[model samples]
Target: MEDQTPTRKNNSYCKRKIVTVLTATLTDVAQQTRAAAQDLAGLSTDLKNQALESIAQALEAATPKILEANAKDCQRAQESGLATALYARLKLDATKLAGAIAGVRSVASLTDPVGSIQLHRELDTGLELKRVSCPLGVLGVIFEARPDAVMQISALAIKSGNGVLLKGGQEAIHSCQALVEAIQTGLAASTVAPEAVALLTSREETLELLNLDQYVNLIIPRGSNSFVRFVQENTRIPVLGHAEGICHLYIDQQANIAQSVDVAVDSKIQYPAACNALETLLVHKDIASDYLPKAVKALQNQGVELRGDAAVRDVIEMDSATDTDWATEYSDLVLSIKVVDGLEDAIAHINTYGSGHTDAIMTTDDQAAATFCSRVDAAGVFHNCSTRFADGFRYGFGAEVGISTQRMPPRGPVGLEGLVTYKYLLQGQGHIVATYAGEDAQSFTHRDL
Candidate 1:
């Protein structure tokens, strides 16, 4: 019994050890990532691409190891009764792995955002001013079940000249470790510092990381609404990702029947677990009787459980959609349907109930489509296209940090450009501001050269 106590204590110590180590490691890595950012900032585009290429290759070589870890996570999630949507998100088989690897290579092929000069102007004889792009150092990314996120985010961090601290959900711990191992191996062959990219394992470590505003420059959280809101409230660091993905698709009266059905089915069924997948669908009253039954039947055949508003309930046989249903982000094989008076009413319902994430309208009527696209206050407003098109890779941004529903400049897909900010550089031969201040001061030339 006495001997067994020490063994039990040792096991307990191992379990709790990483939490303390993670705190210290995060503090240490923050500085290291900043230093790595400086080193990465000056490196050539080709070198960065080379690093990404190495990471992709290393990942491809380590597929079996990664899959084995993922399997363990999946098994545990099943036993723990994880939700169906998250379970789907957590699973990473060969196809998703290949896509993640391919995404890395795609990032490698993107135009380098760092060191790009946005503006160059000669102020006056030899006095020059330039605004150039630079990395946001030490990003802390906290995401949910998708282990593929680890690969995409790390690759983006490397390509964008940013150091990232990744915190994935507890369910995907083993998979995250396996992915990080391959990533670090690739980083070893690159110019980035050894500690530039890191992952924190324990749940306690994440709370500590939120307080690291001094070290972590930006925090991007991708998870449930509560999870994202908690991160935002706890962290002084800037949060840049959207939590609610209550996207909407409206079919105008003039919509092509085949086109509308195809986009609707694909949006909800092709990959319903995606953040940009359709959630609420609004059809014009003029077209509801004609379109609703067909839409409901097709969706039902795909195993989608439909919930509809009162008007929709009259048109299709389905569950009654409550107030809660309208506000929900299913992220599953489920959708809420409604019938609207017209394009404007559809737009109003979307703006009121939607998350400002992604909204689309399917209409052959050019005027109605134009009105809906312009009036709807969402990050992405598409015409005659599926809401699922609102993605970084699909939008040709390579691997993104995430979709930002922020109303600011980085309002949509957060690609490499979103990872960088601008710095104003002034070049002068001892030119003082006094010369440009008062009477008899030199007139400034703001001409672009």
Candidate 2:
């Protein structure tokens, strides 16, 4: 079959027109954002409260339109013969739609991070220093077929006082466009700019938008490793997101066998297609004789294809696992198994091959739990819990833009706080630097909040 994917050259003028629309749209959004930030900063608590309430209601009102748009995307996805996994991610029903609306309301209930003072200090005779949290300006988010991501990021950006530009997968274009329209309608009624949230209409437009680093303060790519890497390589703007989640569940020697089995099963098979879901199982050598067989059998019963190392295959009936299996994120009913000497070996294996998204340790010993949490170089290290719990809504953050594996300001789930940056606010009474330069300078005392 001939490829039907749209290209820039196919419709050069249309692509150019979309870029122009984005530029003009974002320019106006930026101006309004600047003004909104100032106004929101100066507003009384009562007014801010009122705005939040209105936002919640507006999102509630837009639910039916959101669902209708998502239905079209779902229909197209089914017709295109897309992979089952991709189709599942692209499909949105009543539950997901309601969750999206609830996510916006949850964000509205959270304390606004804008204008909140983070740090303060006195540098000299009269120069006062303060670091205040502020919007990160225009945020550009490139993501895959999940339509809820559109609502999650939009609400977070608005609450944090920042503008956003979204580029979703072409498969979900109709759904995304519908979601954006609802957001625009909501913003129109409020003090926020309608263009504060814009969506890319086509893939060609997205490629051009990726290069607009000067206009966008940050670029957050949320999808598969290949897509994220592509965006990272092509864009000059600082990209924040995880490449993959080759997460692990380490069944330590000190673990309770039943509890370990439960955690391991839940982490891998409960929701295998998510980034935080377990991809590998590491069992301690001391417990491998008994633990490995039981865990492997349970996983197999759940329709998981278990690929094991030499030690693991020797103990459990499993197919041979290749070297690449150890470094892969199956994101399906597939798992890799390895036998470790102890905690040291497990930690080393994870640090070397794991994607640092989320990893877990099943142990009864407190000291072992502490060691596992400290040594595992992952965004989330869980003890006695499933790696699947490494989600924004689960963490009580309302919603998330994506799970960031980068070791930066937003390491774990990128939520409302992740959408903001800090600005240094200095207050002074016209004191000159010349006064504090001499030998007899006054000592400064900084007060902590």
Candidate 3:
């Protein structure tokens, strides 16, 4: 009890001082990564691929260390009463680590997007114009739970000729550190600077990182709806990610019951922790009597807890769903079911409550499938398939930065193509823009080159 007032003040002062130091260190790292990104953007495809291969090998070599670190994280998360869904995402076993390593190797085999000419033309004689793809500089990625995201994002960043600063959830700190250390160690053996890829361990760094608009070109946040929205609202940097993933699957009257049941079961239970997993199941009223009982049995057998509307409840026994249930992104084993009058009603329900991430229609009717594909305003619209198919790797992109739901170019699972921007290049023999000026300007040729 002696001098307790002064001790509290001293503790507050220490906290502020530590935060200040961390902020300063983060700024220095951003500057260094910006500089390193410039060097990376100029490297040839072969060189970049070599670097990725090295990283993959390094990750493979460090598998034991990575697994041990992940075990510690899992233990801590378990002891702290972390959500089961999040714990699933946080766990990185040998199989998952091997898959991540394989993904890195796959990224190395992709066609490098840098320097590809999108447009080539001649404005006039000896004046050639070309629009070429280039790197988008440094990316600041903030993700939760998924430590495997560290490896995927780093490989994608390096392959796309961009630098990245990764901020993983505190739950996966040890795993992230182990992964990034191996990545940097691999980069040390390659031409790419290890600084091009870094990990920021503290939550304080995430807030400070958003303020680094000067160095970070984009901020990709992958987490809960509220967390993603917070990142979007706080950052001046352009955000590229979806806030929620309230994906839906509609069963039409013309749907093959066996196929629809399989798709629905797979979508909900295959990997419930994934963002693309089905959350809301809409059934055509005409098919509800025929399909609901079987689908409910299949889903329940797999441990899916369903909350259904009145119409769905009449067919099968389950909990009642509220209006809020329609809009929820239950990245877990929970699902909500509704029975719609027809295709129009199904589409309306989806458009109203869906997160615009991924939605699918299970039907053999070609016309209905085509209509659903065109009318649904989602990043991914599938016919007779599971929403989980809406993935970057499954789309043959090797890996993804994250899924973007904004009504913009980089919507859906963002791959290397989404990471690059284009620049215009004009070549001339001492030519000036004044030559194309008004009045006596020479008639110019706009021929394709």
Candidate 4:
């Protein structure tokens, strides 16, 4: 936590001037990053872990520099009127930096996902086949003002033996640049390629980056709905991310008031700006008489603004919530309350308005909880926990590239396993297709190995 920056051994790839030159064009960076990932795929697990450890050490040692850089971003954001929650995400102090470094160390301790044999099989005489996990080539990760995202993505990429090009929001340029510099410097000291991890500075360059579908295997954009949609439509490349986070928490008739209040406060107040923060609160009409007042008071005590329907307004003093409120994602200390008929009504409302990111239900009845969890269509469905638990680090992913709502292989918190794809390898000794084609066809044995 000293004031000085941690210095790395002299290497041209991470040098300020050199990095700028090396990342001149989006196409060039993509090609170079793909090449780097190809080399990374050949490295041993120990070597990958070493690179992650180096990144952790470097980040811990350079805490002061990172914070100082983040200070500038925070000051500028305040002057320019940045969103309250986004400013919170952008500012990195001693604690958040420590957590980021610890996450990297944890990733170092995880089992390597790449090169692991997923399946092995014996096919006929003298023929064998194996399916092994491998890196997903180069990744283009575009995220918002969360500076910690830079470190997390870089560490995850290295640990999974994949290459990354990180593009952070302009609001946290200084912080992102400093974090990437530290990461590339750490890579220089290890056996990994320094160019394996790069940073994009401008919006123009980032838009250009979305076009490199050939070199960039996957694009993960972590930001607002419009931003993610823009990235998805602008290129031919595959995109992995969610458009919105209109999460919900339904309070069942069988729910306990104290437990519901605690969860409601934690979900909205612990970190209101997060993607998993509860946006809508659904209460069964049968329990509204008992739960509405208590829920309002608990949330208001934490400086939360309550907007509710007519039935909820009758029990509490708050702003009148409209039909549009159901579909809104207020990423702040704002809560929308709606009184539903019962479990069926709550489920219908959530499915109609929820963003398919995360949803939770509070209930003492086993049947109610089971029905709610099974019927709710979301990436994460919780029975009684706070919605804030829907996070990558909380899910023990070491560090996530992003929370994916896409219905694909990498759903939910995308960790090391999400960054890899499998390849089928077949070995045969002088085997000819003619031998198994027609009347003299040989019987093949598909035995597991």
Lowest lDDT block of 10, candidate 1? 1-10
Report lDDT (Cα) of residue 32, candidate 1. Answer: 66
Q: lDDT: which is higher, 1 or 4?
A: 4
| Per-prediction tally of clashes | 0, 0, 0, 0
Deviation in Å, model 3, residue 99 alpha carbon? 0.5
Query: 60-83 in candidate 3: lDDT tens per residue?
Result: 999999999999999999898888
lDDT of 2 by residue, 1-449 (tens): 11212245222433211212344443344454445554544544445445555556766787787678888888877888866656767788888787778777888778887777888777754667889988787788887777888888888877777777787888888888777777777766776656667777666656666667667778888777777777787778888977788999999999999889888889988878788888999999999998877787788899989899999888877889888998998878899999999999999999999898998999988999999899889899999889999999999898898889988768999887888788897778876667656798655555443
- Evaluate candidate 3 by giving its C-alpha RMSD to the native, one decimal: 5.1
Which prediction has more favorable lDDT, 1 or 3? Answer: 3
Model 2: pairs clashing at backbone N, Cα or C within 3 Å: none
State the lDDT of candidate 1 residue by residue for 1-449, as single tens digits: 00100111111111211112343454565676677777887788999899998888989989999999999999999998888888998999999999999999999999999998999999988899999999888889888888998988988888888888888888888999888888877777776665678777666667777878888889998877777777777768999967788999999999998889989998899889888999999999998999998898899999999999899988777899988988999989999999999988998899899998999999988999889988999999999888888988989998788888879868888889999998999999999889888888999888998
Order the numbered candidates by lDDT, best leading: 3, 4, 1, 2
The residue-by-residue lDDT of candidate 4 on 1-449, one tens digit each, is 00111122221223122234442456776787888899998999899989988888777777888899999999999998888888888889999899888888898888889889989999887899999999888889988888998888988898888999888888988998888878877888899988899887766666667778888989998877777877787879989977688999999999989999999999999999888999999999989989988889889999999999999988877899998889888889999999999999999999999888999999999999999999988899999989999888888888798888876767888999999999999999998888888888987899998
**Which residue pairs clash within candidate 1?**
none
- In model 2, which runs have C-alpha deviations exceeding 4 angstroms? 1-56, 123-126, 439-449
lDDT of each: 0.84, 0.77, 0.89, 0.85
Q: In model 4, what are the clashing residue pairs, if there are any?
A: none
Q: Distance (Å) between predicted and true CA of 19, model 1? A: 19
